[model samples]
Every structure is written in C-alpha cells, then in structure tokens.
Target: MSTDNTLPIEHLRWDAASARGPRELNADATAAVTDPGAGRWAFAVADGVGDNPAAAAAARTAADAAVGAATSDPRGAIMVAREALADAPDTGDCVLVVAVGGAGDRCEIAWVGDCRAYLWAEGTLRQVTEDHTLAAYFRARNLPVAPGMEHVVTTSVRTAAAELIGTADVPLPAGRLLLCSDGVHKTLPTARLRTILERAADPGGAVTDLVDTAHRLGGQDNATALVVDRTAEHTANSSAA
Candidate 1:
C-alpha cells in the first residue's frame, strides 16, 4: 500500500527486564524513524535469542540495520538486516519486526518469529502477522492444546537460519497501530489489548498500560511495546484553501 497524504505519528519503546533474575540487562533493542520526504515511517524491534553477552548486541545490530535500511529503501531493509546477522558472530536467535507507514494511509510490515503488530480501527482489532512458533503450527494442524502450554514455542529468532524471515502489508486507516514484543501478548489477552487500545488517552498511555499489565501478570520475560497514532497532515496548499 502507498499513501500520498502526510500524517502525524507518535512512537514509544521500553525494555523492562534483564533476562530473568540475574541477567543484568534485557537482550532486546528497537528503533524507529519518520520520513516525510519518503512518505513513510519505519519502526523495528529486535529480540536477542539465548543467554549470551552478544545476544543484546545482535538485537541492537538487527534493529539498527533494519531501520537504517528502511530509511533508504524499505524493501531492502530486511535484506540489510539479514546481511548484518550473517556477518555478526553467531550468538543466538533474534526476531525482527519493521513497520512502514506511508502517504494515503498505507502501511507495510515485515516480521520474524512471534513479535507482533496490530491495527485498531472502527472498534475492531486485527493482527497483521502470523507467529512462526511450534505451538502455532500445532494449532494450525488441528492439534489439541492445553492451557498454560502455549508458551512452548518452537520457532523464534533463535530458530535455524532457514526460518528467520516473514513479511506482511496492510493499509492503515486514521487510527492506532501497536507494535509489541511477546511479553505484552503473553500477559494481556487480545480482548484486553483491544480495550486498552480503544480507551487509551494517547500512544504513550497505551504503551505504558501494556507494560504495566505485563508486569502485573508476573512478567517472566523482557516486556516492550510501541504505539503509533495516525493523524492527517495538512499541507500548505490544502491549509491555505
């Protein structure tokens, strides 16, 4: 999708863990940019896989590379990130999600693993990405799943090299878009998430409530979230009229 109209946007990012009890720092990083010239805005989140010093670094590397590439060429962002990962010392897995907003209410997203993006419009919530997890596969296969067993993921950023990329595109209306890590999904059900997004005073409040809800539910993993709200940008010619 592509848009010709400019729009106002907002973003936020947070990390609230150090990898369990003694990990010292969370192994995740995120970055975003708004490019009016290109009529697009890009945002990405990268999660380091495994318990290693380089995990966080790898995540940062992925986020930085993805965002940098998006700035120049949204289509090339994933390729740039993949190349960066190839050159970096193999540490573990990392998942990436990149969202690009464009003129005419167009939005595109690319992702790997379970990191997710959601769009809310007209009182409805829609998830835009598929989770590449073992559990998801099982469910797709019509297997019976027990409660509390859903966390046993089979695919993640740490997955084998062959399964590290996923992508999607959608038209974004004048509403809210949510980009988040697994922690938010793990704690807050989709119903609750929708409610929060619907009632949130602003993008910042939505992100805060998301993280807080995860912590309240005994946040076992690092929690992070970003919220973007869209508003039409008035051009000089349009405004003058």
Candidate 2:
C-alpha cells in the first residue's frame, strides 16, 4: 500500500503463512510486506468460496490484486480485485480481507466475505473487521439464522461493488495485528490464540505456529495467518540486520 511521511517505517515487523486444511486440495493464499520507501505495509488473505476447481486460483489472484492496490484507498484495492475476477470468469467466489498501514499510527481495512483481521493489544485481542456472512448479519440483528445459510457470505469482491463492501479504520495499537482465514479462527478459540501470539518472538514464528495450531485443531478449510508487530522492542528488518 502507499505510505506517506506520516507512516512509521521502523519498530514494525511482519510475516505470513498459509496451508491447505484437511478437505482442500491446495492452500488458499496470503501476502504481507512493508514498503521500505514509503514506510507502509500491506496485508491480505483470501479463501476460495466453494468446491469449484478454480477456487484456489481465485484466492491467489484476488489476494495479489488486493495487496497490490492497497497503496491507495482500501476500496480501490477491492475494486481492483473485482476487475481481475471479471477477467477470469472461471474463478470461484472467494472471501477477501486487506489491511493497509503507514506511519500515522492508524490502519484501514477493506473486506468481503468472512476472512478477518484483529488487533491484539495489551493482552487483549479484538476483531477489527466484521464478517459479511449471513450468520454474522443475523447475529448483529439479534435474529435467528436461516437454516443452512450460516456459511453463506452476503458479499464478495467478485460479487459486489466497492460501495457495497465493508471498511474499518482503527488506531494502531501497542501489540500485534493479525489477519487470518476462517480455517484458523474457526478452529481455535481467541483465548488460545492470544496465548500463542503473546508468546511468539517474531512474525514468522507466530504465523507458523498459528497455522500448525489450526491444523492440530482439525481445520476443515484452508488456513492462513499474517502478523504485524508494532511494539518498540522489535523492528521489522531485524532478520535482515
């Protein structure tokens, strides 16, 4: 994503990992990286919607497009994925989540479907993005979910316009930021995840441990995790240092 002078380039480290769960033939997709020049990081995760053969490919393409366009508005990133999806008509529906942050002590998210983003600060982990599934909608309205539609997503990048998508902006927190697919969050409790994240010393270890934890818990779909650390005790390029 694009970053201005206001974005912080130091004291931030990030990493990502993805794995195909028991039922999927291949892994979904994930991306995370910092822009050295502009001092911003773009993060994304995508899961293919159904059993369509092209689902995996769709996830990869959508994720790439989303992160690539993150430099501008989050909506612009989602719209770019929409255009890419239209060009590849055989791709299946997919859920997408994208987060962009710079030096301003703030982060913005754009999402479609159920992939999620969270902020873990001061030992508390809170969801930052809302799920667009029918189940979530019903829960938000305090109504019972329709039978067999709990998993049905209300919108997707390939299926909705920019205006119909979801967006959120939150101040950067003192701890770790996580982006994950349903496979990971669905299989593991947030309390347990907090423990894992708090213990991780680096993004690579944190994400790897998360994927493994989901697998150990019997993930039924592809699982992915991305971690961004803004704590002062660490820096993003320490590995390279």
Candidate 3:
C-alpha cells in the first residue's frame, strides 16, 4: 500500500498453510515471474483437493504449466493447465489464478473449485470468483439454512467432473490482487482479511499475516495466499518531469 512509484513492476506477495490440527505438507504451491526488460509479470497459486492424492499432483503440475504458458499466451495458460490436469492420472481438484501483461495493465484470472481471487481497492474487498461449493449452490437456490451445511461442496476440482473452469479479465487498477486457498478463507473472516491487506507494508508481509491469522484461528486445512501489487510504470519521459 505504499505509494512508492519507484518500486519497478509493482510487488507480489504470497502465503500458504496446512490444516489446524496438523497434517502433511500443504497441498498448495505458487509461482511468480517478472520479465526483467518487459515490465510484465505473472503470479499464480494452486490448491489441491484434500480428498484425492492425485489432486495435489494435478494442482502442482497445473500451476507449473500455467506459469510457463503465460509467458507466450496468457489466455492459453488456463487451457494448458486444464489439459495438463486431464492428462495426469489424478482426478483430484485444483484451483488456479494468474495475472500477466503489466504493460497493458491487464490481469487474467482463471480458477476451478473453491479457491478464490480477490481485488482490494478504495478500502473495499471484492471477490472475483464464485465458489463452486454446495453452500453457494444452496444460497443460489434460496434454500433454508441447515446444520452440517459446511459439509456440502457443490463444486470443486475434485468433484466428479472438471466442470468448474472459469476465467476473468480486468484492468489492473492501482491496487492489489490476492489469491488464496480455502484454508485461509475458512478460518478468517473477510473483514479481517481486508484489514490485514490494507495494513500490511508489502505483499510478502500481507501473505504472512493472512497465513498466521488463519493458524491462530484454528487453521483446519492447508492455507495459502498470493498477493500482486500494481502501479503505473514510470517512463523516462515521465520521470524527467
């Protein structure tokens, strides 16, 4: 949130965690890249479904492929990720989010499952992805609230089929882009997340705060967060002024 204009191609911050009661390594991974001379960059995060062993592998594989594909075809990155997952023998679930083309000041985000992407600007937090969850479905149906609601997952990469693919392209306004897994979201309320994002000095610190907060609040699953900060590039002509 520092208004420092000299920070080059903005800064991206991230964080991740596992379930609260202790578990194996967090089934999540992320990647970030900034083309030295191009001023363009990519940031991505993947969350593997817990119910399937193959989900973790699929998630990591998809993330790697997405980042690599973004270098040439940013839009194709999602397709590449999807195809890669399909080829893998893992029917597990995964979620992906990426931002590229800094020069054009555009961001491309894609995802599957409940993992989410958010944009923070003007002191407001807006969720960019609709959760593919049973709770979301029920809410959409205007169904009455019921107990054990949290147990239902209407949509996820791990669900029977790969039906949760979605994409969004938006202008990267001067603010921040946040990508996170369900572990962090399940534990911390959105308001708290907003406060942390707004207050953190940089992306790294923000991601750390988000993960730490989830752990303190009883992280019941693997938690992860990725932050990308965007600002206008200062050209020599502009700097001379």
* TM-scores for all predictions: 0.80, 0.88, 0.79
lDDT of 2 by residue, 93-175 (tens): 68899998765568899899888898988888889888888888888989988855657889987888777788999877557
lDDT of each: 0.67, 0.80, 0.67
Q: Which scores greater on TM-score, model 1 or model 3?
A: 1
Give one digit per residue, the lDDT tens place, for model 3 in 49-156.
674567668678877777777754544676777777778764565766655655555677766667788888778888887776767778888997574565455644
What TM-score quantifies how close candidate 3 is to the native fold? 0.79
What overall lDDT, based on C-alpha atoms, would model 3 receive against the true structure?
0.67
Stretches of model 3 off by over 4 angstroms after superposition: 1-21, 36-39, 51-53, 71-75, 145-164, 232-241
| Candidate 1 structure quality by residue, lDDT tens digits, 17-87 | 21232245677677776666565567777767655767777787888878777754444676677778778
- Which rank order by TM-score, best down to worst? 2, 1, 3
User: Model 2: clashing residue pairs?
Assistant: 1-71, 2-71, 6-103, 7-102, 7-103, 8-103, 13-236
lDDT (C-alpha) at residue 225 in model 1: 78
Residue 225's lDDT within candidate 3 is 85
Per-prediction RMSD in angstroms? Answer: 5.2, 4.6, 4.9
Better of 2 and 3 by TM-score: 2
After the best TM-score superposition of candidate 2, give how far the Cα of residue 59 lies from its true spot, in angstroms. Answer: 0.7
